[model samples]
Target: MGKKYSDIKEKLQIVVDKKTTNDLAHLTHYFQNHKNGVSQCFRSSATEYLSELHEELNIAEEPNFQYYLPIKWDIPFPPTENPTFKFIDLFAGIGGIRLAYQNNGGKCVFTSEWDTYAKKTYEANFGEVPFGDITQISEKDIPDHDVLLGGFPCQPFSIAGVSKKNSLGRKHGFLDETQGTLFFDIARIIKHKKPKAFMLENVKNLVSHDKKKTFKVIISTLEKLGYNVHFKILNGKHYVPQNRERIIIVGFKKTVFKSKETFEFPDPQESNFVFKDILEPKVDDKYTLSDKLWNYLQEHARKHKAKGNGFGFGLTDLNGISRTISARYYKDGSEVLIPQKGKNPRRLTPRECARLQGFPDKFIIPVSNNQAYKQFGNSVVTPLIQAVAKNIVKELSKINESNQSKIAVHK
Candidate 1:
């Protein structure tokens, strides 16, 4: 009953309003989920957004707001058709994880990200603008999903608060330990939604952060939530030309898997890739380091080498994997620099960075080069993520099949 997304999208381009950004997000998300049984989660707000847009533009034609229209998606990654399972994306940076899961037959019913530039790139590729700031959104507003996915940032738990709570004989569970941090938002949502499975990604250093207290609390928190938690530190080199290592934490609901889950992290495979595999043939001269900066970097390396410190710029070997690409790579490209034939070392182009992270060429980049660096640096290895997601989906399918057979026998 609702108007076509293409028609409203054309009208939205001519509007000069800034506050309507969030409204457009609702409209897109509503339309994206219309056939997925989760449209009700966004229907009310989307209906209101369309009505106001029509009024402000003073369009003579009255549009019916009932249900979804058959939309021909113009985006690179449209919503999956007849998805076997549903998931929600939190802290979804440019949808790297969502892509892997979507490729595994999982439909993303809801997504939330806080950055403005990242949202633009996400919308350009997925055709749905993510809701901003997960901290501001309530858990109940999110649709019911089979799995939850997030790559959340974490802060150290306050020791003083823990001592004070213990002294007062108060229960200091995950809600107390993870409070005042982004992980708390994730914990709270899991406590409310009770999804069958969940996956979280973080820097490998998290395993030893705050002397391992942080990781212990995280595991215990999930245990208290009635889920069997499994974790591993996985390297991206198994699937990409980058040596990025991240910690993946996975959980399965005890009620569903019955505490007998046999989930195993994917074994690392031999890497057939090298640094040169992701290089661009004809890069612009601007990517090359300037003469002055190049000399300064050499001097910096010499000083650190003399002192036996490993804090120097990395000039990657063409035949080997490169160092981890970081979000701060846009600053100086010091971590993973490429060697040049007759000049100073150069930085990886945005497209090369995308390939290093296993992102496909068709993925759109609607932001500046600096923003692209940050987004790609902060993203996961898509092929590696897809490998893990395939296992998760396969496990869920087996469980669902077993349950169906039991019901059939009972009947």
Candidate 2:
């Protein structure tokens, strides 16, 4: 049985003092029922106690904290007195990042994607198809925009590719791999256009890729391009019900705005999401795997267990978050297995896959189930992107306000 409220309170008081009787009551109830673990309970209780302390001390809220609260990082940017900031979507896989920025009142001046099927889905939803082959298109051909966004290809730096490339004796850095070389294209565009800011997303392994040399080069190259670079590893589980980790890099054009301080990534919000919250009750029969495949998976699990490698598919319960979905999900749905009744395990429907990535029901999926699975598995979480975009807009607003103030002083 769980500990009683009074016993828990007594234990908590040793670390947290100065709580009123009413505050303690609320905190005790919170701990007994909250979905998160003790750490969350402690953090929430501490926050509530701190607020009360602030009132007692007559201290004002910090400027950043005041601005941070109540701003739904998940929602798009609020309308501004300044005209809507323009942004371009690069490597726009089905426009996940594009939707986040668009929801925030930012306009897309250009979009680029090389995948034909992804282009179809993107156009079906966004009303305009992305131009093909960013490598072929010059920076001058692209329209001017305040921001740039992309989750560049991750194949080259991935463990799978590194192993293959090392055997071939080809160059291993970003410049050698087909997808790795694309960063040069992004850097060249930034050098020429100098957008107010840009955001790049990639797998978390990118930080430690090639024993840190790969990351060091990326940083130094962007710095030479005259931008202040900031990066953080953000997890999708914080905003959505999936455990996907990615590195987000934000760069500010030094000529437009100069700041010595680093940008702070948004704090993790309370997550109430679960697998059941996104599942489709009446999925098509095609998504259900056959008994033969199910048996194979069980046998695979046992074999891998003997060898000490995890070969079995990961099964996510209705009450918990999901593991990361990958492009190979279409080939074998091995990463995200759903439970079935007295039968073989099943794969999530295409629509369920979309929901896992935070795509709304209204977002059209014009491709085949296999294609849909691959696309969403490769996409970003809209809420996560939207929240980070909000922070970027806030910083840009400051720069705009500062410019106006300087003009007024001159007058």
Candidate 3:
């Protein structure tokens, strides 16, 4: 016969006293009244008591203890079959692309973003911190993925930059700038990974940056790397309440490329929102603009209006669309101004800023209001990305089906 209850209890008590004093004392008190000696009956009761205690504590049994483990409730593992297509998010920002793809049944295998604040927000929402500085990472170190997505830095090719390329022949297209020239890193990775597809986002100016030369170079580069590239300018107002405009570029690996499909960017939906849509009804003193600054803006707008120039700030109405929200919005409330009851114009609150960019309320905004403004201003509109991703997935599925048919015939 196996060891008796009382005998096991005595041995366990010695072990417990040495390893866990307080728990042993309490356990011994509960079993102290049992009259059975070191016999099978005592051993059976000790096992039951310990098992019940384990249950109450919600502790997982060690794998080595499986043979002695008692029956208990089990947690169902998440289904892995028919798993979603996996992609990596480069220059992830706040995971705008990741959110878009995830909503469409795609999974993120890896993400990289250098900004610490954006990474914090990305982790808060996606439960994963993005790796930093893509340029420092090796191509071989990246995991295998079917898709690659990024809104790589746009500063090098932005209208604000000097020595900008004016054509595909110029090196300044993306490879020449030192401050924010990271696109070639993306090119190298794509050359090696040969993902089925990739999507890139940038400012609208990128298309016309250098008399169409910049855009031409990008398209030709991807072609040389064996990809069928398609690109278009998409507006956020089409999918959200904001009037932000951006360029979306997509490509399919040359090996998997097929007959081109018409890439229709989603059209703007009827939006009834104005600057008022993102305003706070109750004004906080912190948000109230200084009378001096307000006077300066008003005078500046008047001067610009006199010159027939729309370059200066203007008060937006409650029923009209807003001007584009720029990264410089943090500097002054000049781009999009709101009409106030008796106070000066105020900048949009961080929450309102997030909403303007089509960020869901569940999205985390863990940074300061200024950082939030910059982040959303830089992020791609989620809905627009989703619409474009849908088209890419559709085209890829067709290619995959064709390949399957060919395989079947050969077999």
Candidate 4:
């Protein structure tokens, strides 16, 4: 009998643990997608990896060599059995955007993330390991899909990114070839695959980066690819108890929507969540700040205040929203710190960070606390992404229905 995901899950990891390449990503992705049309994209590589594993382990395969059984989908976030549309996730940080699209009836055919710790967390919850280094992956290698979803690397255009780069006498934005060119990879894939629609999420500062020139180039490039682009700055505060803002860029193929797609970004929902809503009733004492660190934070805040600067640790109001949680949150937890009754304010526990990003309690955090904090801090507010994805999917359905009607009339 072919092995189920559960049957060989440990063996596969053993194989993965022994590898230095990204072949395990292919193997896991193939196991998840084999029965679907998406498998062809991964089969050759996955099969080779599986064969190597079987030989090394001295396990005899069936005469025909059944690489996998129908996947049991025993992971925390399995793919939908019957998907309404397909999408690809780029820069998929721990599957935040993936969850949003999946909830909206979209199947993720491909996903890529380069971070080792983030990939571990993603595979733990989603069952499939993601391909790494999107820049090295060819556009033609990606599967065709209805939508492309990416919360692309934003540090190149963020305020903090620019400030740090300036201090180090380094380039930021488009001038930073190391990271800035990643957007072109997204554009390259879009131009090749020509998905019906796409959604990109980035730091709010992206709109004003390089004096708006960078944003202008991005918009113009999509237009040149024959897409009708619409974008807006949306805040997570409306969905989560955090005042985080990001720019969402949506594009539809002009040939598909004819510049007449009736798509609109979702209006901000009511802010019903508060800081305490996501906080744990009982947190470990280790999360509490050290007296030395607390005193240093206080003195640092005083000096910044004296200099007329707004830089300081934010002691969150239990009943109110918090400042934006950031990837640097793990360093000092200065952006959003919880107050204690008698002790120094504490950093948010890893689980609390996940909750703040609208992740469910069932979501697994298999990484270290520091890595978990960074992953969640870099993630999207799930409910907010879902709200927007709902609208996008609705429009895609309408477009499909219209196309079907045209075909029926012609027949």
Candidate 5:
């Protein structure tokens, strides 16, 4: 009923920050349920939350049946008007995957992001601050959902992670790893929630990590949970301008989709993507590297060259794809530097980073440059996720339709 989501956000923020027992996750759940006309699904709790919101807004309690929402609104990336499915985003980094599935008629029922800066940016755009930590939040607290989406931290199974561990002569992957526990958290939630479908993404090397034992545990675990699992190594460059490759795991609950053997990953896009597509029309001078840093990078590259190692800063080719952007990009703009005709190479502006990861221009970057770089570098390519989400929805809907037909026949 509010015009601008900013006002609504402030009001919701008060409720979230209040000293009461309720928290952000509870508020978001109530808001989504209220918006989607499904408050009855959690009747007693919904009524209590509605009363609290009404008191806070200084409004009379309207009938729950009158959960009317505007056909159009003023917020950036407003909630879907009608949702075909409900999803819960775990390890939701600024809600990138949530945005993709929402575009495909999915509603985000729950979200969890731990970083303060990330939560701020997420709230700015989505008007919902994600729950602080997934590990602390019990699976029972999560709202019922049809699909579960998580871009779980890749560091535990990534090339860099394994290399660092191996250099230190420490075990990596499932053994003697803190992050190894997180993967089990996902497994526990899946076993508890038993959502019809799920999608998990990690670095491309996950398939080869620990002599493929890491990936084997993942696949076998899902299969043991009665899921028809499929995974593929997909490069984001096909969908965006960055050459980020991640291994994607898709699964359908065998108990729900009895014919789950038919599940398939999305075919990779054949479209050509280049750096210029995401580059800004005009860039700020602040992005240009200082002479000292530039000189240091050159010397570093020269030293590596002398060693016959191909390690150094990557000067992006305007007509071609770029090296993978990483979380450490902010430390130095070495991974993907852009050349200027009369100036030193520059790091991509925050906006360019967002575009490189397929975030639309409307998506807000309310955080500072440092946080923005980290968020975008760690995010998934939305268009690529969209393509994969479409296939998952198609398979789920087909099974749903078949189930409905069987029910009809019995009736």
Candidate 6:
């Protein structure tokens, strides 16, 4: 019998140090658990690789088929028992959104993410490695899921759609539409799966992108797909020690929810969140900005101020929240630099970044510093996502309750 994810994860714990080995373990885990069986060719290849890995690593013991995951507070975030609903994690960066939904008693049925380093960290923590490159995936093969969760890509759509295309001699067509775009995959999957609900996250600028035409198209697309959509811009500062802001787009199938049924994003609650809460007591000297770099930064800031520009390295106060952490944070930590007494400001440790994003202490950072920074920077605020997911699940529960009541009355 092919090993399940729970079994494969144990084997991987020994060989996951190598990237290629990690990738093998991840792929095997995915195919082993997929509802749609892997094709014979793919299955054989994966199995053969595992067989070689075992021999190469010199394992001599019988396998423990009876594998059980740890509880919620452990290293890996396991699926909830008798989950209330199912969700798919798309563009799943280190699974911050997955953790949020899982806490709300949702099981992840499908996952897709592209970054190799992020996948390493994700598999380390989630057990199953995510399928990659959303554009390459076939929507028909996706399993049926109740809720679709994705933090989709949001490159600004050009405002002069007609003018730009006309100048390039390309007509406004499939190529001009969602073709070759990641959102196209989301649209196609929702059209095929017709999930009961979906929640999407993107940078706050998505609303104003291309002067709102981008958002307009997004809404129209979902409406055309028979879903009623609701959206709001939310700040991570409300739940964590960072001032990250993102927009969440949530929608419900018209068939599952009545036309009059409305959905609201979770209201932000007052939080005593601050940088001091997530800061590490001790950090390596390497994280501290060098004298040369620090001097250059100060000079750059002075020049900017002289020219009436506000651009400068953000020095975070221990008692206050931090500025946004971006993928480029590892380059210099300019956006959320931490101050050191009588010393140059330092960058946040990977662990601090994880905590800032509401990830648990047990969440492993298996990759290097650069990878960790990018992964966390691109990740969602888990507690904030959790609050929104709770509302979504609650609404879904209400629908289920109403349906059951109607069935009982008919009986």
Candidate 1 regions off by >4 Å? 1-8, 14-21, 65-68, 154-180
Better of 1 and 2 by TM-score: 1
| lDDT, model 1, position 313 | 92
Give the alpha-carbon lDDT of every model: 0.83, 0.74, 0.67, 0.89, 0.80, 0.77
What TM-scores do the predictions have?
0.90, 0.77, 0.74, 0.97, 0.89, 0.83
Residues 1-411 of candidate 3 have per-residue lDDT tens digits of: 223333433334323111332233223322321222212322443456567656765647632223232212111211112434768889988888888887767766656777777865765565444656788777876657778998988766666443434443545545565634687788899999889889999988788866888778787888888887878887888665567778888988766665365555566566655656666567567766788888888898889889997668756666776777766677776777776777777777777777777777767687887888888877887888998888777776777787889999999
- RMSD of model 6 against the true structure: 5.4
The prediction achieving the highest lDDT against the true structure is 4
> Which residue pairs in candidate 5 have backbone atoms (N, alpha carbon, C) closer than 3 angstroms, thus clashing?
none
**Ranking of models by lDDT:** 4, 1, 5, 6, 2, 3
CA RMSD for every model? Answer: 5.4, 20.1, 14.6, 1.7, 3.4, 5.4
lDDT of 1: 0.83
Clashing pairs in 2: 76-104, 77-104
Using TM-score as the yardstick, the better of models 2 and 5 is 5
Better of 4 and 5 by lDDT: 4
Q: Give candidate 4's root-mean-square deviation (CA, Å).
A: 1.7
Identify the leading candidate in terms of TM-score. Answer: 4
Score candidate 3 by TM-score against the native.
0.74
* lDDT of candidate 1 at residue 10, scale 0 to 100: 74
Clashes per prediction?
A: 0, 2, 10, 0, 0, 0
**Model 1 over residues 256-284: C-alpha lDDT tens digits?**
99987777889998988988988988999
Q: How far is candidate 5 from the true structure (C-alpha RMSD, Å)?
A: 3.4
